[model samples]
Target chain A: MSNNLTIALDIMGGDYGPRSSLPAAVEAVNLIDHLTLILCGNERQIRCELKKLDALTHPRILIEHCSEVVNNDDLPSSALRNKKDSSMRISLDLVKSGRAQACVTAGNTGALLAMAHYVLKMLPGVKRPALISTVPTQTPKPVYLLDLGANVTCDSEVLFQFAVMGAVVAEQAQNIDSAKVSLLNMGAEEIKGHESIKEAAKLLQCSEHINYIGYSEGNDIFSGKADVIVCDGFTGNVALKTCEGIAKLIVHKLTKALNKSLFNKFLALLLFPVLKKLYKRVNPDQYNGASLVGLRGIVVKSHGNASKKAFLAAIEEAVREVERQLPEKIRYKFEEIINKNA
Target chain B: MSNNLTIALDIMGGDYGPRSSLPAAVEAVNLIDHLTLILCGNERQIRCELKKLDALTHPRILIEHCSEVVNNDDLPSSALRNKKDSSMRISLDLVKSGRAQACVTAGNTGALLAMAHYVLKMLPGVKRPALISTVPTQTPKPVYLLDLGANVTCDSEVLFQFAVMGAVVAEQAQNIDSAKVSLLNMGAEEIKGHESIKEAAKLLQCSEHINYIGYSEGNDIFSGKADVIVCDGFTGNVALKTCEGIAKLIVHKLTKALNKSLFNKFLALLLFPVLKKLYKRVNPDQYNGASLVGLRGIVVKSHGNASKKAFLAAIEEAVREVERQLPEKIRYKFEEIINKNA
Candidate 1:
């Protein structure tokens, strides 16, 4: 296995644990070349699952034993403090040392964030790590939204940094140059929102590091107006969840309306092919993972309820992130900006 | 025309102004029995638009002269101070002087809110007004979400009152009794968010005026889990707009994806019927208006870019609000709760 191709995976994380994680790991290993997986969890359970896939008994697959499991209900700090032998902690340690290039988990998000912060540490010039997700907008390319439920209380500097990091990811990972960044506000005016957003607008406007495209209201997020949308965690989290909720509602309503009468049911039958295509486009499960940005290494967080498909997507995302060397690119960008300013 | 059915409409409001307002007024007068409309704006412009409508000569219509107009860019306080002859100011005056049962406008939202607060005054228990809207969810019925874009900063008491008002509108106006009221939070847990939300949860937990259904996150807004979803104006506004943005993105993506190739183009032709039905189901123009709740009477706020169709929907919503006597029902509900506590 290549030295730069190792991933530390928390096998005892997520709702279904080995049932979902094992299949995803196998799929990822099969699809990607020259990759090694350092699995951290209950050794016996993992081996049993690996035994189910006879071909997985390769030199590239290594198991790191960890007895304790970080429960979903456990407080983040408590897991970090008490569960020293937990799978999440052991996987993070792999990334901390030279054993792994990145980490992937569908475990307790708070615990994962805290452990990554305590272990890998933030990159230089990065104040706090932000969670970034690619939202499929109407544009040809997806839009990147950052600080999604990461830091609820953020200042202008934090948001400004988020924009810089978001722009870097969009350019390197998404292969889009000159990424447009917009600050999420109540309105499209310079004087909207509370003190934090207003202050962020001013700082972003002055920063030569990013292509700050002034203010954008929530409606502009998916309107193809900006490539990178930055906001405080509270607002970003609410906005993201609201969009998901509404999409689900719209699909539900369409289905119900189509099934109301015999004539409508016949129409539904005729339109089943198209309706199925539309459903596939809007399903949340297709986009069920987020990446923790501004860290020294890649850390992809999958949904706790993620199935094998979702886990595979997360693993694929981690692979792309490592291949792109996103962290190093961000560091280089920041240093150039700092040197220019100095 | 019934003496109690007079509605003062801002004829010089909105981007289209009397062009959209006059036709909407005629439609309302024709649709609702015993309804009268007092058109407040420049008499000449009102007359010009009125002449376009053959039904403008009906006895139910009256024009009140107001020379000045509140431009969209005017500051709220400055507009109030400088334009005494503005349609917004004159309409509010009609409400204050008991000449009209309600005032509807598509003018500057800030100026309308200020005039609404200044002239109509808040109910005894409400600290500020809430902009409430009915969002059609996946369920057969529409859900009511309050503080859409009104009060940005809200305390526990204010949120509690918004919940009560939202529930009243859902039950009386929308005819959904036993309405489930939910406080929007980051998580469903009791200890989530800042102190205000925690306190609001406690108040809702003990509230008897509405059916409090515990805490709901942003993801639950479109799940039909709650009939009335309440949050501070800042979050509510962001949530509403984000939903709109995502809906537009979905339609845009579908159209683009369907036109990519010959086979897809054929598939698009096959699916056009169902897609058109779904598009109409989620169009914002069909639901383009919001009600300014906690007022002495119904005050509907239509979008500035509202076309004739949107204006027609707003007039229908106002007619329903008047027929339901939403203000009196809210008054009774609040008074009952206050008296019980006292």
Candidate 2:
């Protein structure tokens, strides 16, 4: 690990713009001793935020101005084609040009991916990049779920590629040895699911590269079962949001229930420590970083409505991925598979 | 409504055989004023269970002996082909022969659907039967989620049919008149999702029969934003199981957290009442019955491992559907569409 670990922050993206990103970047910089930050956005806004922390002239902190910001509603293709001077594009340029080891953005995810793909391009032998995120489980660590929302529509080949890419992340980034890979399906049975998934399953089963486990139903995602679960982006996104919705619904119900009685209020007070711990473990903020896997360089997308803490978590993931040389490992893995096929 | 609304119970089905079904049947009989039950299964086992409940001589309760039982391992085609003497088949026969208005089973869902379809056949214009279940939401009533695990794969036309069927059920059964219908997709935007979903979205949008709201991600399932959600069985099944998994994980984590310390234990005691309500509300058993929709006859599948209370819920759903003439409503809706096309 080098002492010159630099991660770029897209300070002008996300709902809160610089408000959340600036504080979160500072938090990450403070948390990681060897880290330096390249804040790419409007110079005046970045300077004002830095002055709030009284680190305007810090040696490690560098602010690069971009003329425009990529708003959440901006079309990905339009942003890629038109918003060349936007903070999102400029920050990604830092990653593409090797000026920063990694880039983190709490911005429009589609725009970030679109720009990153156009700028950084995919690694050799990789068909497409998948959105990779760590979903919570009963295990000491989280399971890696990929193709969360990047490619809404996918075929068997794309799904197969996701398995290969996800396997690498599960093994290298998550550090799961002999990582068990499973195709996310409607049922665990071999006969279940659609044609593309069935074909993808056959491909995975025959491949010796991955420890291809059998099909995993949605429930299996949080069961602490498979190390990596792959699905077409559509199903994966629905499943991810489904988990969030249920958690939100449960928490909402619990809140309403807890507010009903004095005894319930007392119980909540007594249970605050454990409840807080449980909530923290399941919090979306705790698992906010979603890596743009299959990209040539490290780029992590923070939740659009992320708070400062959540954005900081995304920065942490980017730093970790950069330190591990995630792209290098994925490229090596992809080339290895290609050579084997040849 | 006459006092002759009879329902058939597949007593030999499910894990508990006659244990859960007999009690559930009795509970349904007691709960509904104009209800009778034909307990169809092995004569000796039915008698033993009936004796246990002291229901042997009840005039409204009739026993119809079945020679064979359909095991979960039995293939759907084999169960339909050879298991004619099975309790599941015999129960469907009761519905077909006009001895019962509905059939209830806590058995292999595939076997039940097969036998029910073989004996009853599909309603005109309905291509395939979809499994429908009401998942709890923030709304006063739960939202109807369909294709829980019926059709493994679905085409655009089939998906459109699901929307129609779901809309009818939402209107007549769930009583959401002019139900807001939505296609389950990864993204809400029109350009997002796969070919079939995009096609289905067009069909839904163009059709005036359903109050077709656009695409709904998994979160919207519980947000009470739409009354009915329709998707292919694979995605729907994964989404449904994903909800179950998250709920289980949260409960498991909460249980572990609650037992961590003396303070937590004390809090658990004070929060017992509210926690109990929350648990009851979220329990899978509370949502036991899932209707086998798009079929000509009303059939309800209970969770195979359902408790007496859970099985009772399934029976209650069947009773409600039979009383409301759900099949007739769906048939009329289907025919109306067919006539409009013609």
Interface RMSD of each: 2.4, 1.6
Name the lDDT of candidate 1: 0.82
Q: How much lDDT does each candidate structure score?
A: 0.82, 0.83
In candidate 2 chain B, what residue range of length 10 has the lowest lDDT sum?
B279-288
Model 1 chain A: lowest-lDDT 10 consecutive positions: A279-288
Off by over 4 Å in 1: A1-4, A260-277, A283-288, A335-342, B1-4, B174-178, B260-277, B283-288
DockQ of all predictions against the true structure, Cα-based: 0.57, 0.74
RMSD of 2: 2.0
Across A85-145, the per-residue lDDT of candidate 1 in tens digits comes to 9999988898889788888898987888888898889999889999888777666677888
Tens-place lDDT digits, model 2, residues A233-262: 778888888877777777778877777788
Q: What is the C-alpha lDDT profile of model 2 across B37-137, one tens digit per residue?
A: 88889999888878889888877888998999999778788888998888899889988888889888888877787777778999988999999988878
* Docking quality band of candidate 1, CAPRI definitions: medium
lDDT at residue B161 of model 2 (Cα atoms): 95
**Fnat, one value per model:** 0.63, 0.86
